[model samples]
Structures are given as C-alpha cells and as structure tokens.
Target: MSDQTTNQQQSAAAMNEPLLSVRDLRVAFGTKKEPNEVIHGINFDVFPGETVAIVGESGSGKSTTMHAVINLLPGTGRVTDGSVQWNGRELVGIGRRDMETIRGREIGLVPQDPMSNLNPVWSVGFQVEEAIRANGLAKTKKEAKARAIEVLEQAGLQDAERRMRQYPHQFSGGMKQRALIGIGLSASPQLLIADEPTSALDVTVQRVVLDHLAKLTSELGTAVVFITHDLGLAAERAEKLIVMYKGNIVESGPSKEILQRPQHPYTKRLVAAAPSLASRRIGAEATMPAAPTSTFDVAALAEAEGHGSKPGEPVIEVENLRKVYKLRKGNFGSEDFVAVDGATFTIRKGETLALVGESGSGKSTIAKMVLQLEEPSGGSVRIAGKETAGMSSSELFELRSKLQPVFQDPYGSLDPLRNIGNTIMEPLNIHNVGDRESRKQRVLELLDQVSLPRELATRYPNELSGGQRQRVAVARGLALKPEILVLDEAVSALDVLVQAQILDLLAELQRDLGLTYLFITHDLAVVRLIADRVCVMQQGKIVEQATTEEVFENPQQEYTKNLLAAIPGASIELGIVEAGDHVPHTPVAGSGSAPFAGGGQAGAQA
Candidate 1:
C-alpha cells in the first residue's frame, strides 16, 4: 500500500479505540449551603484520533463540562453524577496519586488563558522543564531543559533556545499560548483538552497556533476535546460538533451537518450571529424583525456626515509614524526594535478605519500614537487639524477628551473596587461634566443606551458578564463624548452573539453620535462587517490600505491576501437557516429567555 493508504489505515485503527468517553456527566458548584447544579447529564465520546468541539456562549456549561472531563472543576465545583472514563478508567473518583500520574502523562490540558496559566515570575524554560521532569520525560534537569526547547520549537515557537530563558511577561500573547501548548504536549499525552486556547489571539496567529496544534496532535494520535464559544472556529476545526445550551446537549453531530441544518434554535442563533458564517451585518433586517419604525436613523447620519462645511477632514491623520524600542541585549549592548516603521491612515468623521495585522504588526502602536499615549520616535500625528508632535501637556489633555480607547480586556481596563455606576461616573466626575445628580442620571441613561439593565448600576465590575463589562467600557468611552474612539480588539474576546451585539451597538452609536472609530483588530472577518476602510499592517509598516470591500475582494499585497485567506472558517460555506427556522435574537448573557419555544436554552450570565 502507498504511504497515504498506510496512514489512513493507522487512522482507522486509532478511531476504533475509545480514548475518552463521557457518560451522563452532571456537574455542580457553589457554596456547600447552596449547591447549584450546572452541566446537566451531558454525554459525549472522543475517539483516539478525532477532534470534538463543545461550543456555546459563556456560562452555557461548555467549559464546565470539558473541565469535568479532566477532573479540574473550579472552586467547589464537583462532578456529582456520571462517568468520565479514559480508556475505561474512571476519572471522576480517581485517586490523586493515579490522576497525577495520568494528568501530564496521559491527559494534558492547554488552559483558557496562557498568560494567567503561566507563572509570571518564572522563566518559560523553567516551566516547560518542570512539566517534562514531572512527567518523567527526561532524565536530568539539563536534559529536561533541552527537551523543553525542543517541545517549544516543535510547537512553532521561534527562537526557542533564547526565548526559553525569558519570563512569560516578555512573550507576546500568541507566543505565550504556543509555549503553553508546548508544555501541554511535553509528555505526548494521549488526550489534550484545550479550553478556548486561541480566543485572545490574532486571526493569523490563531490559524498558526491551531495548525501547529493539529499537526502535532495528529502525529502523536492525540484525541482533542476543544471548548470554545467561537462557532466558526468549531465548524472549521472540529470533525464533530456538540452544541450546549444551559448545561444541556442541545445538538450533537458532524460539524458540517450541524452548521448546515441545525436542529436547535440556540445553535441556529449562534450560526446566525457568527460574522464569518454570514455576509450581512449583525442584526440586519434580513435576520431581525422588520418594523415600520425608526430603529437607527442611518439616513439622517448620512445627511449629517461631515463635521466641516460640506466634507469633514479626517478625525485622525498619521504620516510616516515610527516607534523604536531599544532593547538591552547585554550589559552594554542594545538592539533597536522597530515597532512601527511607517503607518499612515485617515479616519474621517463618522467613519471606521480598521488597522489589521498579526501580533507585533504595529496596529496598537499606531493606536497609541493617535491617542497620544506613545511619543513617536519619528513622524507626525494630527488630531482634527492640530499637530500632536510637540503639543503641551494641557493641549494633549485636551486632545484626550476627543479620543478615548476601549481595550481588549475590559476587566483589566476597569477598576475592581468601583461599582459599575461609579466607574462610569468617575470619568464624568473627572471631567466635571455635570453636577452630582445630573451625572448620576447620565450614568443611568448611558446604561439604558448601552442596552444594559439599570439595576446593574450598583454592581461591581466582577458582578457583570464579559459582554456587560465591555458595554460599560463603551459607556465610559462615551462619557467624555469623544469624537474618536480607538477600539483595540474591543470585541475579539466576546462570543459570536455578544460580539455581534457589541458591533451592532457600535454601528448604531456611530450613526446617532456621528462618531469616528479607529477599530484595531486582527480579525479581517470582523473588519468586513464594521470597517469602512481597511489598513493591513506588516512588521511595523502599513502594507495595504483600501476600502473594506476592495481589500477583501481584490487585495494588492500578498500579505493582505494571505491574512484574508487565513481567516478561520473562510472556506466553510454555511447555509443560512431559513427565515422560518430562525429564532429570537437574544443577547448572549444576562438573558434568561429561551431562543426557541421550550428549548430550555436559558443560561446563566458569564
């Protein structure tokens, strides 16, 4: 037989073996006094060489179920009922001694956040070596270190030898995730559980990481259980799809079948909300309720388009921007790291200009320069018409009032101690926008405008869901009534439904407020939905800039073309569920209503 045939035969043999089998899995968590049940009696199977994805919005029991498989339930959470068997060995009641032997040796986990999972104080190499040594993969510490480098290199981490000595803080988000994968595969585990592994990564970086993970797992015959909120990614990567809603398995089948003909309303809504699956804008009339009323007056927005006489000048303008960070190579020697070489873009009033690129592509650097956060080593940035190169402190402060940023990590951006109301009001208080009573009213109004319930105003940031927190972030951005809002991967971390809601909200706000948005993201698919123009960045320079449709349809640069091609699920053609089959367009979290009648898809807030 040919090599292909032989490989196929091996694959067939692997698939015949049941690697991990989960049956009637029931999980519960909360205080001992009030034991709350989540992950209601779910069942699934994983073959030795197959991939299965458990997908749903946050708190839909997807992650909770997967976490139960590995017996790693968080904070008082326990596998109350059902069986998690690996090769017929029970995982639920397994002894610590036995689970320890199996954890890194037979079952490995690539956690949700690489940054947090990795120890900040320790060197990356030390952590990798520890995993190898703990798994008995290497003989000596030196051998473990060498083996750790090999694993990282195998995981496609560049300069593995040198980077191994560096701390997790020194590595980029994508690189850190690669290192985590390296640690997960250090012992060549039979089963790998990845919990939304690349949710925080750039699109290109996500593809690269997932590709490397696939190649390594396939070569080692590792069965993968992927937990994610991204439906498009699940459709493209997993051979089998498991749709979960409110702790129940709503649907399970082949990925393509589930995508094309979803039986569950929750699944259909997820399929509808994913930007990569549909060509239309989020909450478009074709998908949503068509009412004979004023929803969002885009016609009036078009009429009041520009800020100037007839046409407005760009809200932000950059010319030949450059930022060089000098890195200390040795005791005396230093190396110049050029973050942004030459990036130029213009965002007109009421227009959204997206800066797209892989990590370290200078997108955020350009945003910082435009926000006046970073002093450019060379080049010029103009806000409205005034040059910001040598502006005074007061002038820069005034410029800040016109431009505000919404960060990728909303929780990190927000203060933990402050309540949501005070958090939003703090900005107004700092700016002294209005008196105390009026500012309180403004806070409540902003909450309503963002579609968040007013009752949540008294709650702290931790009490809110990820989507709600991001909405609060948007509310704070609007507190100053800024003309230009720099959204740095603002919606990337959210699930499809939440992401769609946020995007739609931004679009609506842009129309009503005539806001100028600088959307910085790596997801070209998202850019297609929200941005008017696209600027593709490479290294530290702008390689391509054109209308959003032009860049997606006809690209000039090979880099831009490759970036567009690398978008996850770009090839998966999802058949839109018929209008009759569609369900109510509910927000992702904090909504208890079922997507379908009696679907029992009501999930807790994330």
Candidate 2:
C-alpha cells in the first residue's frame, strides 16, 4: 500500500471513534459522608478534529464536568459515578501518576484567568519551555527554548524572542493569555480544553487569538472542547453546542440549530440576553413580549421610564483633558508619554455616554481624571458648572461623595477582610453620611436595590460568586447615592445572564434615582445596548462621537467600523427576528434608549 493511502485509511478509521467521551458523569464536592453534588449525570462526546462547546452561567457545573474528566477537580471535588473515557480508556479513579502523564501530553487545558494560572515570578518563556520539557517534546535545553519561542509566535505574541525574558506582570492581559495558550499547546496535544479563554479580552484581540487557535488546532487536527458563557461565540465557533443549566444539560444539538431554535427555556433566555446577537439600547420597548427569564420583569425593564436630562445642562464637562506620564528611560532621561491627549466631552445630568475603545486607548485615564483620582496635565474638569481645577482639599473630598467608581475586578476592588455589609457601609462611614444604625439600614437597602439577598450581608467577598461580588460592588457604589456612577468595565467580566441582570438593574436605578453613568468599555455590543451616545477612542484621541444608532448604522471612522466588525458571532444567522428591528424609538439625548443597527455577523469569516 502507498503511504498516502495508509494515511487516508487511518484518518477514516479515527473518525469512527470519539476522542473523549463522558457517560452519566456525576461530580461532587466536600466530604464523602456529606457530599454536595454539583455535576449531576451529564453525557457528551468529542470526536477527533471536531469542535464542541459547553456553555452555562457560573455555578452551572460546566467547568466542574471538564475538571472531573481530567481528574483535576479543585479542593474535594471528585467524580462519584459514571465514566470518563479518553481514547476508550477509563479515566475515573485513575492513579495520579497515570493521569499526570495523560494531562498535558494527551489532553491540554487552557484555563481562564491568566494571572492566577501563570507564575508571576517566572519569565513567560521559562514557563512555556518548562511545559515543553515536562512533556518531553524537546530533548535539549536549547531545543526547548526554541520550541517555546515558536509556540509563543504561533499563539500570536509579537516579538516573541524579546518577550521570552519578560515576566507575567510586564505583559498585557492579551499577551498573558497568549502565553497561556502557547504553554497549553506546547506539546501539541490531541484534545484541547479551553475554559473561557477569551473572556477578559477585548473584541479585536479576542478575534485575533481565537483565529490563531483555530488555525493551530486545524493544522494539528486537534479536537477542541471550548467552554464559555457566550452563546454567540459558542454558536459561531463550535459545530456542536451543549447548554448546561444547574448541573444538567438542558439542550444539545448542532450549533446553528441550538442558536436558531433553542428548545429549553434557559437556552431561549440565553439567546435573548446575549448582547452580541443584535444591537438595541437598554430600556427600549420590546417589539414582542419576552418570557420571564428571571426575577426581574423583562417588559417593565425595557419600558422603564427614563430620567429625562435637562436641556443645555451638563453635569460633567471635561475640557481639553490631557494626562501625561513620565516614563524613566535608562536611568537619567525620562520620556513624556501622553496617556490622554486633549480629550473633551460632556455628560448631561441624566445620560449614559460610553467611552469605547481597546486596551491602552486612554478611556480609563479619562475616567480617572473625571473622578479626580488623577490630576490632569492641562485641562479642566467641571462638575455641575464648577471647575475642579485648583479645588481645595476639603472640596475634593466632597466631590468624591458625588462621583463614585465601580471598577472591573470586583474581588480585587473589594476588601476581602470585610463582610458584605461592612464593605457597603464603608463609604458611608468614611464620608460620615449617617449614624451607625442608619448606615446599617442603608446597607440593607442598597443590597435590596441591587437584588442580592439580605442574608449574604454576613458573608465575605470570597464566599460570593463573581456576579454576586459585582452586585456588592454596585451596592457600594450606590451607598453614597452618588449623582454620577463611573462604571469602568464593570459588567465585562460577567456571564450573559448576570450581565443582563446587571444592565437591567442599572436601567431601573437610573429610572428611579435618576443616576448618570460614565460607562467605559471595549465591548461595542454592550456599548450598543447600554450607551445612548458613544465616544470612540483610539490612541488617546476620540475617533468618533455620535448616537448609538448613528455609529452602528453608519460608522464614519475606520476605527469605529473595525470595532463593530470585531464583535463575535456578528455574522451568525440566528433565524429569529430581533425586537430592535420592529420597534423604532427616537434617541433621547441622555435617556439611554436608542436603536442599534447591526447583526451579530462581525468577524464570522475569521
């Protein structure tokens, strides 16, 4: 037989068998005597060279199921029943030594949260080379170094050779994620499990990373098990979709079929909540009545009354905002780096003006200047017609009471040592807004406003889920009842359902309390949903500024156009009609409702 014929036969035979299979899998955590089952009887299969996606919100047991399959469950988690077979070999109850051998060499894993997964003390190249050497992919030290560089380059890291010596802290978030991908694929494993790999990345960088991953996996003929909470991304990348809800597979089918015609109520809610599907600002009337997905009333949320902004009344006026940093060059000389260059904008009394851009685009810097966290180089920030420049220390202190910030990483932003109640009350205590009893009452009320249970007040930050922690963060931001809330990538880290709930909460709060928002994010889909008007920033300059509809319907700037095109699942045919198409609403200057004119078809070819 010819070599080509032999290869073809081998490929054909391999297609008949599954690369990884799970049957009636059950996983539990805690003591054996008092076990808490998290993953109840789930089944799935991954064929060779196929891409499968498992999607669910946090605590839905999606990650647990994969961890059980690899026998690497955290803490006391273990597979109690059923089977996890790899190439027909049972993985349940496998010895640690045997499982370790199979882990990186046979089945690779790209974990979420690059900062926690990567060793901060070690160089990025060293980590990659270590994985290669451990898997015995390269024999010599020099060869391992070469292989590491090659893997990093393939994973889309620029200047791979020079970056090898840099530590994790030196690399950007996208770069850190790329390093993790390189390490995960260093051995060229047959099956790769990517757990929310691009969750934290911006749209453009996310597209680039996923494209490189797809290319590399295709070249190696490696099957991928992609896990995420993004339904649009799942539908776009995976051939098959498995929707898990509270430890059970609620729906499973072809990706497009599942997206177009979700049978389960949970799946239907997921599709409806995904911002990537279509662009429509929040608080707009629904064309069709939406089914109840959560405790919040979807219809009421959509039709929630807006807090009308006063004409010609600007609450925040940033005039020619400029922030320059001095970077130390060598030892003696310093270079001036302009972080925010002559940026200017205004936020009305009740409006959401989103500052959208990629990382290092100076949106956050502008936010800092607005909040008076950082002093501007050459500009003025006026709050309610009062200039903040040269303000007295006492006046700045009062300024902080009216302008509060809700940051990105809730856990990092929150004090781990404090209980939820105390955390929320800290702002009030520092500002001396109320007495002790009043502060306690204020904390409880804030929790209720954010839709968190009152019992959680006694719990610590670590005890709460990601979404819960964010709710707590919002409650803290609202404790002082600040006039303007500066949410900097606040909902970017949350899953779809939780993100929807947060948006709903923000809209409701805006209606009731008439709060103003300065939303900063790289997510154009989210910008479309929550922002009334958007300021597109690029390289420390505002590339475009217009209403959400105008920006999406007809982008004038190339950068703005590219941002719209980078949204994941922008090209997927959901087959269902969007409510935004039927309902046409006038764009209120600061009321936060506008029509979004785009489909989830961006970067489909990529």
Candidate 3:
C-alpha cells in the first residue's frame, strides 16, 4: 500500500542518521583564574528509538553534562572540547539563530519541578501554545491552540478545553506534570530529555508517567535521554545505562547487565541499598542463635544487647483529638482557619502507625502536638499512660527519653556545625546518660546499629548523602531508645531506591527492636510497604482508619478515594488492590518526533 511505503520511507530516513552523537565531550566552569572541569572527556552515541539513562548521585556531573548538551549551561560554563552531531549535521558550533530554530522543535526538555515550569501569569494552554508556535508547527494562532489542546489531552489531562484556561496554581502536582509533558511534546521533538521527571511525585503518578513515556518512545521510535539518581528506576526503564560519578562515566552498559550485576563498586552499593522485601527475604539472617532462655521476648534480648524490641503497654494514646488555628486578617482580625478538626489517632507500643495525607492535611500538626513541639488547643496526649495536657515543661522533660522525633529534612533538623557523633550524643548528654567517653562510644555503637560505618562519626552532616544523614537522624532518635518514634516525611526527600532502603531499615529495626512508629507521609507506596495500620486524613481530620490491607483495598471515604483516583495508573491492577477493583482500558500512545539538528546542542552520549 502507498501508506506502508510512506511509513517505510520515514523509518529509513530516521534510521539512516544518528539523532544525537557526542564524542570526547568535556565541560568546565569558573573564571580562567580558577576553572573547574566538571565533565571529563566522555563519548557516547544516541541513535533513534532508544532511552539512554545517565544516573548518579548528587555532584555526579550528570546534570552538568545534560545542561551542556541542551546548551542551557550557566555563565562561565562551556564545552571545552567535544564534537556534537545531530541528524548528520554538526551542532556544537551552530549560530544562535539556528539554535533557536532547533530548541523547541528538535529538543524537548522536561525539567524537575513542574510547578516552576509554567508562567504564573499565563494559563496552561498559553504555555503549550507558545512552545508550539516556537517550534513553527502551526501556521496560525488558532492552529496553535488546537495543537496545544490535542497534546494536553494526549498527556492525560482530562477536559483539556476547560483546563487550558486555568492558571498553573490551580492544578495539582501530577496535573502540573502532565501540563509540562504536554508542552514538551507539543514541539514533536525527535529527542526528549527528562531530568528527574518523577521526583517528588507519588508512586502512582510516577508509574503513569513512566508508562506513557515508554509507550510514546516505543511507538514513535523517539530517542530519549533520561536523567535520574534512582537506580531502581534506571533498571526498570532504561535500555542503556550510563553510570556517572564526580564528572566521569564510571560504567556504561545495558541496563539489565549493569543493574543485575554492576561492575563498579558504587553501582553495586547503589543497587544493594534499595529498600526491597525481596532483598530482605533473601538476606534475613538465620535467627540470631537463640539467646539464653529469658523472661522477655527475643525483642527484649536484642534490646538488652543494644538491639532489643519488646512490645510493652501502649506508649502513646490519643482519642478524638482536635486542634484549630484561626486565621486573622481584617483590621479587627475576624478570620477563622480550621486547620485540624477532631483528628483522632493512637500509636501502640512496638508498632508503626502511618498517618498519611497530602499537604495541609494536619499530619505534621498531629506530630507536633504529640512531640510537644506545638501546643494543642484541644487534645489529650497520653505518654506512658498519663495525659500530657497539664504537664509542665519539667514534667515533659522528665519523659523526653520515652518519646523522640526524626524530622523530614535531616540537615534542617540537625545542627550543621556538630559532627554526627556529637549530634547523636546530644540527647545522651542532655539526659546526663554518661561521661564524654561513654557517650562517644555510645554514638559509635548507635551508628553501627543504623548500618553506618563507625568512621563516619567524625564527619559533618554536609558530607553525608540524604539517606546517610537520615540514618544518622534515626540513630539520634534511638540514642535513648524511645518507646515511640515519630517520623514526619523523614525519608520522602530520598530517591525511590534510597527511600526503599531506609524503609527496609526501619522495618527491620521495628521487627528486631519492636520500635513503635507514628509514620507520617503522603507517599502511598511507602505506606503500603511499611504500615500495619493506616489512617487517611483530609482537611485536618481522620476520614478513614483500617489495616493497611483494608485501607489500600477498600478505601471507604470519598476523599481517600479521590486521592487514590488522582494516582496515575490506578486503573491497572498492580496487586495493590483487590481483584474486584481492577478496570481494564486500552492505553493511549504518542508518536516521537526528533529534535532539530542545528540547535547547537551537544549530541547525547549513548
């Protein structure tokens, strides 16, 4: 057929050329007086129809390399050496006019933060339309609008016509991401570069975007350059993987080969640290030679040996709790803001109770009240079977060792000037546990408990990864072996795999030490993996509370249902839900359009 012939011709044209090719690429920044070379000579080829992922931790030069390729590098930064070719044309030394022509049409970029991607003054439609216009894909303004709507719909934004009129602030995080994707795809570029595309997104949304990107690339044969720090994601998504470290490609190979058995030590450690039940199942040590017969459970023995966890009486109890802060505005200050209303919860001894909700759901407020960080207008917090309502500061301090909190932002929560050892020893020092030598020894032992190397005790917080610092924070919380641990989005900032590892560590600690957790987060995937019981909160109140299994399977409340619905790929049954809730539907796929060659951007390293 003629149509078949035309398609074949197009495929042939695309296959005949490399969309982006980089050779001996190097980048440097800073003045001539003091220049810093961040990207050492690196070479790779990116052909048509493949997803090449460059992965590494912070300061790995992955971002810098990508910036050079896109010609988005900051001042004082330049490609000191390299040859970049796109579509059989040289791009490294192209003029600005040619680069402008290629930017939107030839190279589509999806930055990390979707909220910041769009203009505050403009509607979502306008942004996409502008991209379309820049790409010269449409002849007229009307044509541009139509194309924009089509792309938005393709990005999975429902009611594209009406939604287009709304400003960026009106959309949720996931929706904002869809809008960004729409803008990126509107140009129909041959190459798509996504930088931490799904970071900060819910697992469900992350899944949906990944699936969509995969389908789009596969169908249209679009070459994709994906950048992320999450190794598990790289394993699941990329066909070719490039491992970078401090500005060098330490390892490069097929995803399966590299991830299954990485050749590099860094890669191996990265893979080993991901939180996984499978890993735990495979690695669970043989029941530590049963301790000599004892009156307490195994948890008690472990704790006595400095790792015990024996479930005792309920450590913290709350019933029908409520806290409301009035928002005062007008001259007389008459505005009322009901932040939390009738929020009720309880944490049993040696159990992890996850309180989950989106932003402004009053989860943090609850944690603050329990930690006595904030005074509750109306609520009863019982610690060690006694209500804390009328307790004085001295009384609260008396029971401080029994309750502890590990916050989300580790650096913010910790004193930056103090080394890890001092940070861990502070609580012990405050409680007057022991002399300096004993406290220092305890810090080292605690670090060991958290799987941190003993030598890291002298290192400052700035030297640790987000995960390592969080582990330090956890060690601090356990310094006094508190009966309850309140973690407020503690691991949310970490990469998925790091988050997974931390969660596994927590679960292991809980299992081995019987530590009770009031885990608070908005991440459902984490809630699924850790919580024994889950409380879904909305508008500062608990709308539902059930076993993790029950809540995940049969979420009863409308708000909880909406949160689930907002999740990407919810219709697909991933074994996270009961069989009855499964809904089957055909997937919508998109075409891949290659970027323009004359953009003056570096070719992607294969």
Winner of 1 and 2 under TM-score = 1
> lDDT tens digits, residues 397-433, model 1?
6666667888766656787766777778776666556
Q: What is the lDDT of residue 148 in candidate 1?
A: 94
TM-score of 1: 0.85
lDDT of each residue in 1-606, candidate 2, tens digit only: 999999999989988899898999999987999999988899989998888999877667877789899987876788899999899899999999999999999999998666567888888888999999999999999999999999888777766887787677555455777888888888889999998777666777677777876776678878898888777678888999998887999889899898998767677767777886266877747332332233322233221222234644898898889988764444577667677898889888768999987665788788888888889999899987889988999888877877889976575688766777778878877776646656666666666666666766666775565667878888898777677899987886677877877787777666655778999987788887888889998878888989988998999998888888888889986644344343211121231212211211222111
Ranking by TM-score: 1, 2, 3
Q: Which parts of model 2 are misplaced by more than 4 Å? A: 1-7, 118-175, 284-312, 323-338, 374-380, 385-393, 435-441, 575-606
Instruction: Provide the global lDDT of candidate 2 against the true structure.
Output: 0.77
Clashes by residue pair, model 1 = none
TM-score of 2: 0.82
Candidate 3, run of 10 with poorest lDDT: 597-606
Best candidate per TM-score, number? Answer: 1
Residue 428 in model 2: shift from native, Å?
2.9
* Ten contiguous residues with the weakest lDDT in model 1: 593-602
Q: What's the lDDT for candidate 1?
A: 0.76
